[model samples]
Target: MDIELLRDYCLAKPAVEECFPFGPDNLVFKVNGKMFLLASIDQQPLQFNVKCDPEKAIELREQYPSILPGYHMNKKLWNTVIIDGSLSTQQLKEFIDHSYELVIKGKKK
Candidate 1:
């Protein structure tokens, strides 16, 4: 998914907000002040990082080459998904949902 699509998806989540806390190149999506997704605006083919369960993270990386260890993030708990048409739009939305849910769940701890 592209930046705008990703932005809309994230903002649709409850109490979600978008900001460039790291810099202009990175678009960060946070829920209740905790980050769940980070998209690089300066990259081609587009890519974004999403929080994921450790085991599921590895499983995704193994299942899809477009999905890899998170860039500049804790690899065990995050993933970098390349928007290269290999994954459907629905799948991308699921990734965003999972990330948002994970962040919200973590907030309770």
Candidate 2:
């Protein structure tokens, strides 16, 4: 999905908000004031980092070329996903959903 679509999708979720905490080039989506996903607006092919379960994160990287260790993030808990047309739009949404849910779950603890 493109940046606009991604922004809209994230905003549609409950209690979600977008901000440029790191700078104008990086768009961060947060739930309950905690970041879940971050998109580098200045990058080509559209890449985003999302929080993921450590084990699942490694599994995804192994299963998909477009998914990799999160750029400039904690590799164990995050993943950098490249929108290189190898994955479906639904898959992208799932990644965001997983991240969002993980953050929400964290808030409960």
Candidate 3:
């Protein structure tokens, strides 16, 4: 998937907004002012970082080479996913949805 598609998908969620809070190189998507996903705009091969359950994070890293510990993020709770054509679009969207849901769930508590 491309950055536009990824941006659109994230923006489609309720209360979601995009910003460059970490400078122009990083595009961050947030819900209720809390970040759920982040993309490095200046990078190649389209990749993004998303929040994930600690256990599931490890599980995914083991199952998919494109999925790695979040670069420069909390390794236990985040994942850096590469859109290298190794995974389907549906799977990528699922990652975004999971992160979005997790942020919303946290806001409720």
Best by lDDT: 2
| lDDT, model 3 | 0.96
Q: How do the residues 66-88 of candidate 2 rate in per-residue lDDT, one tens digit apiece?
A: 99999999999999999989999
- Name model 3 segments beyond 4 Å from true: none
- The residue-by-residue lDDT of candidate 3 on 38-90, one tens digit each, is 99987889999999999999999999999999999999999999999999999
User: Between prediction 1 and prediction 3, which has the larger lDDT?
Assistant: 3
Alpha-carbon runs more than 4 Å astray in model 1: none
TM-score, model 3 to reference = 0.98
Candidate 1: the clashing residue pairs are none
Per-residue lDDT of candidate 1, residues 1-109 (tens digit): 7888888888988898899999999999999999999999889989999999999999999999999999999999999999999999999999989999999999999
> Model 3: which ten-residue window has the lowest total lDDT?
38-47
Q: After superposition, how far is residue 87 of candidate 3 from its true place, in Å?
A: 0.7
Q: Which scores higher on TM-score, 1 or 2?
A: 2
